[model samples]
Target chain A: MRARLLRFGPDALGKAGVVGSGRLYAAVAAGGFRRYATYRAATLAGVFTNTVFGVILAYTYIALWDERPHLGGYDQSQALTYVWLGQALLTTMCVMGTGFEEELIERIRTGDIAIDLYRPADLQLWWLAQDLGRALFQLLGRGLIPFVLGAWLFDLSLPASPLTWLAFLVAVALGVLVSYSFRFLVALAAFWLMDGAGITQMAWLAGVFCSGMVLPLNVFPGVLGEVVRALPWAALIQAPADVLMGEADLLGTFAFQAGWAVALLGAGRLLQVVATRRVVVQGG
Target chain B: MDSHSHSHSQVDGSFDESHDSFSNNSFNESFIELDGVEKVFDVRKKTGFMRSERREVRAVDSISFRVARGEMVGYIGPNGAGKSTTIKMLTGILTPSGGRLRVAGIDPSRERTRLARRIGVVFGQRTTLWWDLPLIDSYKLMHRMYRIPDARYRENLDRCVELLELADLLDVPVRQLSLGQRMRGDIAAALLHDPEVLYLDEPTIGLDVISKARVREFLRDLNAERGTTVLLTTHDLQDIEQLCSRVMVIDHGRLMYDGPLTGLHEVGDSERTLVVDLERELPPVEVPSARVVRVEGPRQWLAFPASESAAPLVARIAAEYPLVDLSVREPDIEAVIAKMLHSMRDTPKPPPEQAERSGRAAS
Candidate 1:
């Protein structure tokens, strides 16, 4: 046992070293970060538009409900909170535009993917890490800041417990993982289909409608709502919002999120492996 | 006598064995290997939702070559001749339909990451450097990506700046630099990791003569000093002539010729032109071993096989005419290559000026 452990130690360390050495993840992270810095003006405009849209959505909900007891187990305050949360998470989760898929297609067309293939890190994992970094920056710069400002102006419900906050944090992290894996799977379509943009747009549309970004999943018809809740898309946004509102049990909510994360990430990995094999066979 | 004969046979056997080993070693040391590689692309036409039209285009058909360690090989072909397709396969950007490829001792398709670590590449028309940042910042970012040690990074940066003459351009953003400056900086960025192999696709495609000379000089020095095997694909024959001793010419997805540069000139039966200026108007004269191409005022021009000795033709013309001035021009490589490509039909004639000179020279 000791010998085996000793042998495995160096190999594991070496693998980690390789990942850190910028073969895949580091290059992508650098690229994504640089891209964000360059597109600062555009990001600011996107944030402004998103915040204004959130306020309009909150006002529209207020007119419909008008302090009437509650609709779909959410009061006016909770409804307003949901609106702000959805707006913030929209940017963080990249609900409007799954840009990574387009990036992958362009990379494929231009043969830039060759640079990524040579890296010592898994391409999927590298892209996920870079996306995660971008999400973090956007969530802070575009998502969280805008939401806080909007909430202060609109009198939205804030979470009451540190436990709820902690749960919300975990949910958001898992949400990003699940969301990125799903997007990556869509991006891998470039290997098989020549114009992957149409399919990518459809995937983003599905996420927007089903993930409760434009409206809460509970508003869907009974059977459709049930189906939507069970899907990974809802878990990326709705589950985090539920946790923040104290409407979900911490352990149960996280357990479901974990399940979705594992399943989606596994699916992504399988698709990536198969897509890469096709690329090798077809010379994409 | 029997013992002597046996010893001689033994020596010959060992020589053969060593020669075989040497050939195998040469192939093994190559950074890239394409063995009977074939890539056939399916050309499809999609019309609304119906079944699409399908046509087959053999982009890279049964091409094979080896780029040895530190050997700067140029892969050139006309447009749509599968140069990019072949490059894509070598870099693991695309896969071959049939045949095997190994890059940097790894099957590029199977062990892409391992191969990537051993090679650095740059596409001339595209900017891989960050568009917004200064060239130095981009280099620093690449340093982080490749995880170069700080000391080694500094040393390589210093050397690249000195060799590429990039000291003045480092502070400028890539978007701001002139094409020549940007190209030099881009090449430096690709070399930061000290990759054992470098692939440059059209590195001098669009540059002033001085810039082209600087790039060629840098590439030549880098190859000689570092032994970093290079695979360059360019439309510029001047680049190939000056930098590459060996040339591989591909046409219509097939390797037409792969040998020394001299072999290119030898493959086709072409002719060199000799222009002679006489002190007086010259009458056309019939001469053996040469064709009289044209006659103008005081000048006469003639064409002879490039393989034919210039001395004999020059001596013949001088003995017959009062020669005031004389010069010899070798046929352009572009014309030669074009002729070789289109030789199945009538070859395209040289430019009018060249034709006039050749006509006058031949007459």
Candidate 2:
């Protein structure tokens, strides 16, 4: 697979006129990958931070799961896995860093979005491809170390089947698409509001709380559990984590993620078209 | 490349003839056409606590013009004069609020993506290159994004790299490149797809003299060699003087003047200020063709027709008055447009004396 990817050269990108060409998206994804790969120091700092947070959260979960055994239908082992999974997926889902949305907001505020509009590509898909590359990088660079550390130190539920790993990858990919779509909609508010920072903050808060970053949605008491589980944010970290831990039906969880990805991406595409129509490029 | 050796004098002559023909509405081969195109922006300003007022700012009022293929045109105006607004409308970034606009027979705003393949734009204030990636990485990405064929991509890349002097800087990240280097990199990125029409907004805004000259030379050659149409907006009059044979002036969202470069001076009634330092403080020195616009102590400022030779005015002053030292200041675009608008408000046509002065200046 690596050799095949490397073999795709300039000619493989093919003609420019065709829309939705796989090679075109692949190149954009590669560009995105290379763009983030330059920040080696930032990646190191993020890995350190994620590992530190995972250790802290794992100890806290041990204490809580000890007091209320099998709370929210999760055994002690499963709860530990959930805690570590949250730490691993934090940056992967962009629950912690507002990198993509902040960049989009800055582009809109400074009128640099005009340069983006000049390109012969769909705006939403272009950003989606870039975000996928970023998520892949973050998952490998930041997600793995914390996960490995957690599994080594704590009694965590581990999946051994290659087939199950494949399902987890598919679930995470859909989760990334849903995350990008949701953030994209919030960023598009910059066209009307002129500054998306406030909305971005609110979006981030909701993502952190409802996506089960702070605590698993399954632990929420009463009606809130059902409510949080239904939100699009749940599709980002909670659903993917459930798939990884084998705590939920594989097809059912995949269906939930795929459904939110399609709905949110469709809404994002619609908002993008409308927002670009009234884009007031701030500077001459 | 051999055709590039054709003297600019011939190009200027042809441009003047085309200018006359264009004004007569006789040219039918225009690639960019705008008929009474308009763009109005609604801005809401905060006045007091929880109070705001909305106002419609007509950024590009009903302005119309046509740019032919292979013609290099200069679009000049003061800040907030709607110059960028019009370019935005032309590039389909900002849809016009009213009227018909077409580029290469395609309605730009309606079919913006299709039009994008044919046109390239450089916004001097912003960069489209990926900030964290190497300069060559941006080009490689553009190579795929535009999907220029492998052979043609290499050929165009080689040409731009050779002409723009981008070989050494390709490995450096975009953020590490200086403004001039980044600008060149950007220009090269825009041309890699072989766009037929190129729009440059303030391409030489912050470039130093050598860099500016190099950029201008590259642009001239690009236009000459590829026959690519160019619409350049700039504050630097020298950019207009050296690069463009036909200049269009826009102010207050209106097309104020569209003609040969020399005719702009005539219409604007622009003047050169001659600063004369006398031996001592005295009454304002008088000359036949120049008038003292200001006098302080031993120094005096004389305003004369910009098109006229300052040699005769200097000689007359030196022989008749004590001239310690003198220097001439060329009229800038803002001052020229201000004077032109002032004259236009006062008279529908050029006053007879001003016309005669331009004639003498021409001779």
Second chain alone, TM-score for each candidate: 0.77, 0.80
- Model 2, which residues run further than 4 Å from truth? A1-20, B1-28, B41-57, B275-287, B292-301, B314-327, B348-363
Q: After superposition, how far is residue B12 of candidate 1 from its true place, in Å?
A: 21
Interface RMSD of each: 5.7, 6.1
Q: What is the model-wide C-alpha lDDT for candidate 1?
A: 0.73
Candidate 1's residue-wise lDDT over A105-127, tens digit each?
A: 77765556655564434677667
Model-by-model lDDT, in order? 0.73, 0.82
Instruction: Give the alpha carbon lDDT tens digit for every residue of B280-318 in model 1.
Output: 986875688788799988887888776677998788878
In candidate 1 the C-alpha lDDT for residue A47 amounts to 85
Q: What lDDT score is found at residue B144 in candidate 2?
A: 71
Model 2, position B143: C-alpha lDDT score: 76
